[model samples]
Each structure stands twice: as C-alpha cells, then as structure tokens.
Target: MQSIHFISGLPRSGSTLLAALLRQNPRFHAAMSSALAPLVSANLDIMSSGQEVSLLMEESQRPAMLRALFDTFCRTTTEREVFIDTNRSWCAKMPLIADLFPDARVIACVRDVPWVLDSLERLFRKNPYENTRLFGNDGERATVYSRMESLARHNRLVGYPWTALKEAFYGEQADRLLVVDYEILTKAPEKTLRLVYDFIGEPWYEGHDFDNVEYDAPRFDEALGIQGLHRVRPKVAFEPRRTILPPDLFKKYEHMDFWRDTAGSRANVLATKRATREDTTTA
Candidate 1:
C-alpha cells in the first residue's frame, strides 16, 4: 500500500513551514492544499452528504472521497510513492483521514498555546484584505479559533489533545506517524530534515540540498483567489521569531506540564529556550 503523507496542525502553527521543507524532496510534489472537488465529484457519495467542513474546506464523503483523492493524487503527480499535503485544519479530522488512507503518514506540527492564540488574534485583527477566501470573515475566524481552543480544553488535565490525536492516529503503529516540532524544524533545519527523510523512507538529498528549490505556496492559493493570506514562496532562509509573549500570559499558558510529558522535556526546553533566545536576539 502506498502512503499519502499529511502535515496537519493548528493554523499558524507552522504547517506551511514544514510543508515547504518537506517539499525539498526531489521526488515529492508538495501541495499546500489538495483539491478534492474533481475527486469528490467523480464519487457520488461525496456529493450527496451534506457534512459541514471546516472554514477552510467543504466536507465530503469520507471513504469514497479519500479513495478518489488518493487515486487522483497518485495519477496526477509524477511521484509514485508519496505525496504531501499541508493543511492545519486537517489535524481535527485525523481519524477520518486515517481511515481514508490506512497507510498514510502524518506529521502534526505544534506550538505553544499563547503563541498560537496570539497569532490567531493578530490574523483576525490585521487581515490586510476583507477577503472571504483568505480570512473567512472575522466572525468565522473567531468561531473557528474558539472551537480549536475549546477542543484544546478537553485534554486540559494533560494538555495533549493535539499530540494525543497524532499519537493515536499514527504513533506506535510501526511505520506511519512522525511528529515534528515546529521550533526544532525551524531552528535546526538540517538535522530535522534528515530525520524526516529517514522516517518517510527517502534518501537524504545531496548535503540536504534544498537550498534553491522553490516551494511557491501561492501557486495553489492563486488559483483559488486566496493569495492574500499566505506567504509566496522561494523562501530559502528561516526567520526565527524575535518577539516574546508578555510575562503574565507566558506564565499562564506555559503552566501546562502536560506539554512536557507528551512532547518530551527536550521539545519543551527547546520551545522555551527559543522563545527566550528570540527575545534576547530582538533586544
């Protein structure tokens, strides 16, 4: 069975960043978001079901739609073994997607809650354009943001809904799931990429040779008329954040010891160190 790899996470949690890095694999045609309309239309089951999807996508029949999608994805792209799609909202629907492609691989990106919340707030407050396609309207953004945080609340005791979902869907299953930290991937691109390549069963590129390869994400958004929302590609360098959350908010959000347990003390240490490093760098 072939694997359809997915990169899922909270919006602004660095899904695109990870996707761009993974796309460096010469054998993969990484799509920011896969188009399911044609595949869904070909399968009647998807058309009939009136399931409401996330703000970013319309829901379709799970089994049929996913099969058709994988089939079409395999057919259209020259790459035979694996193809990648990075969609943050897909994290919420991992169970269904896992059912769709039983053999698929997934990378669930994660960041600190305060950072995620702050990004959500900024995205809503400063959407440069009032474009429905990009920001999905202020009301919708607020609702979706609320829903995500609410979902996050469910595992409040452990603070590991996202990580737990990733694990349940992909982890400890032998050959399918790999969780990549946003901070590590961004800070130490080479080491992380090597690990990812190995996990996907692909050879490391020449000296991790992703240097000049272009991953213009806007190529996909442009066709959908939602170009204003994302960064256009050809990005070659990592720009670590130089800003830090206020001390009070940081303390409040950072108290989730569960994050350390699930992500490991290493990742937690890196996340905090990176945040502090950025503050110093900026100062």
Candidate 2:
C-alpha cells in the first residue's frame, strides 16, 4: 500500500461520516468498520497455538505473514493510492500498526461522552420495534441504566476507545496521531479536511461537497435491527438541541472529554474549546 491510515476512536463520533467524506477523493479508499483486526487476531491465536503444526513456523516469519494479511485484505485497483481502515479497535492496536508500518497514522474522531450515549439512546427510542445489535438481542428491552452500564464497562463503547485513546495520546507514538473533534468537523469541514490532508502529507484536493454527501448501508443496518443508526444527513451543519437524557444523566458525563484538557498532545484543544464556546453561545 502506498499509504495506509486507521480511523478509530469513540463510537457515534463521526467516524462513518469521515469515511464517507474521504471516499469523495478518488485517490482514497475509505469505508465503515471492517473485519481485518479480528481476522488478524484470530490468525495470531491459530498460529501460536501449542499444536504440532505450530512448531514448524519460525518466529521470524510471523511479521511477514501478518503484514501480508493486511496487504491482501486492503489491496485495490491502481486508481486508489491511499487506504483508510475504520475500526474502533484499531486504537488498541496502535503499537502493532506502528511496528508494522512505521509511517502509518491514526485519526481519532471524538465527541462528548454524554452526547455519544444520547445518540445511542435516541436511536433506541426511534427504533422501538427492533432490538439493537449493539448490546445483543435484548438491547431493546434494556433499561437506560443497564445500557449505560454496559457501555461504560471495559472493552465496550465508552471504556475501550477512551482507554485506548489515552494510551496512544500519552504513548511514545503520540506524534503519529491526529485527534479530530466532531464539533469542529461538522462546523468547518473544509478546514478540518485541510488539516487532515496536511497531517497525512497529501496534496489537498477540493470538490468535496460535504453538504450533499450520502452515507448509509440500509441492508447492513437492517441486519443489525437498527435502521438509520449510521445514516448521515445531506448537510454538515450542527443542529444544537436539548439533551435527550435526564439532567442528572447528562451532567454525569458532561465533563468526561479528556481531550479538552491542556495535558493531551496531538489534539486541537483550542479549536475544540472555541467550538464549545460557540455551541454554548448558540444554545
């Protein structure tokens, strides 16, 4: 691959929208979450097992085999020169990616934690007839507290990406990360895309109509019993509204965004803060 990057971070945080916008560039190939990470993990387990067949494989060949797996999985026509793989788990696999492709970067799309949960709640309320596949078949019947608890648990939505992002933010490979705030992205897509292209060392391209981009997989959403869950509107404007959650619940995570702090590097803290001020003033 000429260029490879990973799109990860919090769920319901504009990852899908970012992928849709990136695909507008003919030179880039971007999509929703893929199965490459889980497939690679499974392959590692199978190869390292204590079975007799495992003894024949040398440790030196493992890296090549793993690299080949990604190369084969992401291979495409010559028209596409850059590939953006989307998966929330990629943040946790940053070390492995850095080791395999030293020049690869990760773009983390993030938003407020309360808003993320609220978005999920809004979907749940909208599709009352179908149980969301996110928390299994019983998601429809799950209470608000239960759903929140499940999301806050380790390896789940709020827990996994938050932990993994913090790890990458403070780790040695922090320079290889670009933290994109959802607020800024929706409010100023051109500026955000320019920043992204600059970070990736690619020539900036125009002609992307963020206002009319359509991104949704109806069949896939139907399979998950959550239609319109991944849908993005035709425009990129931010619609400020009241929180769907109770006051207490909304306040619980109102200050949960750690990227807003001054400590985290490789983030647009000032821009995010400015966005927050503008949002508040508009509200």
Q: lDDT of each model, Cα atoms only?
A: 0.51, 0.77
For candidate 1, give the lDDT of residue 77. Answer: 64
lDDT of 2 by residue, 1-283 (tens): 5588989888788888888888889899888888887888887777786855568898878789999888888884334889888888777787888999998889998887777877777777788887677785365247886777677667776778888887777777777888888887888888998888888888987879987887888888898777776787778877776666776776676777777664756543313763221231010
Give the top-scoring candidate (TM-score): 2
Error of 1 at 7 (Å): 1.1
How high a TM-score does candidate 2 get?
0.90
Judged by whole-model lDDT over C-alpha atoms, candidate 2 comes out at 0.77
Where is the poorest 10-residue window by lDDT in model 1?
274-283
Clash pairs detected, candidate 1: none
Per-residue alpha-carbon lDDT of model 1 for 1-283, expressed as tens digits?
3456777654455566666666656666565555643344444333444533423344544465568666766667655456777654444454556567665666666665555645544443454453434333455345544423443554431134455544444334423445555566655668877777776667777634445434445555555444433452343345555334455554555533233344422121123232442411100
Stretches of candidate 1 exceeding 4 Å from the true structure: 37-68, 77-80, 92-102, 120-175, 219-229, 232-259, 263-283
Q: After superposing candidate 2, which stretches have Cα over 4 Å from the reference?
A: 49-54, 76-79, 137-140, 262-271, 274-283
